[model samples]
Target: MVANGHHWDPKYPEYEGKFTGKFLHSHDFKGVTNEWKGKDILVIGAGNSACDVAVESARVANSVKLSMRSPQWFFPKFLFGMPSDVFAAKTPNWIPSIIKQFALS
Candidate 1:
């Protein structure tokens, strides 16, 4: 990630019209203009990415609104039915790195 001139724009371009991972579902209008700092922010998506942006933007913005065009297939972020961040936190640090290497291999 490259944060140049107040924007953290990725230096890389998309690969063959595909994205490799989850990301914040947001608009560039607010980020480039800084008009979204204190206004009611509305995100128009329902994937996990959208969920993350909604949560993060609410922290700095006055309010948030999520506008979904269609229903998304939602899965609870969990481990054995409980939210997974807790377990992920407890996960051995080497495990994720190893898993990532294996996936790329």
Candidate 2:
């Protein structure tokens, strides 16, 4: 069976009701536009989408802020010489699990 895990509904913060400024969901974000220029932006969450939004917003927005409930460790796109995901994909399955763990560490 195939399963699609995407969530359609956005989980907004409790304080969303009290805020009066412009608010948008990541699901609805198209790209940086003229309206976004010089506007202060606040991106919530620490997931891939949130990071992408914050990075893009910083380019055009006057200021960009990221808020996360907990700390998250971020890794560079490249590990050693190649892309981190590519490195993982190229690893031979025959390699011992312990060796793979050590190398990743």
* Most accurate candidate by TM-score: 2
lDDT string, candidate 1, 1-105, tens digits = 111122344222233776453333243323423544676665655655556666767777788777665666554476655566675566677777877445333
lDDT of 2 by residue, 1-105 (tens): 001123376665556356777777787778888898999888877777788888888899999888877898876677779998998899999999899777776
**lDDT of the candidates, in the order given:** 0.52, 0.75
Weakest 10 consecutive residues, lDDT, candidate 2? 1-10
RMSD of each: 12.6, 6.4
Candidate 1 has its poorest 10 consecutive residues by lDDT at 1-10
Candidate 1 collision pairs: none
lDDT of the structure predicted as candidate 2: 0.75
Q: In candidate 1, how many clashes are counted?
A: 0
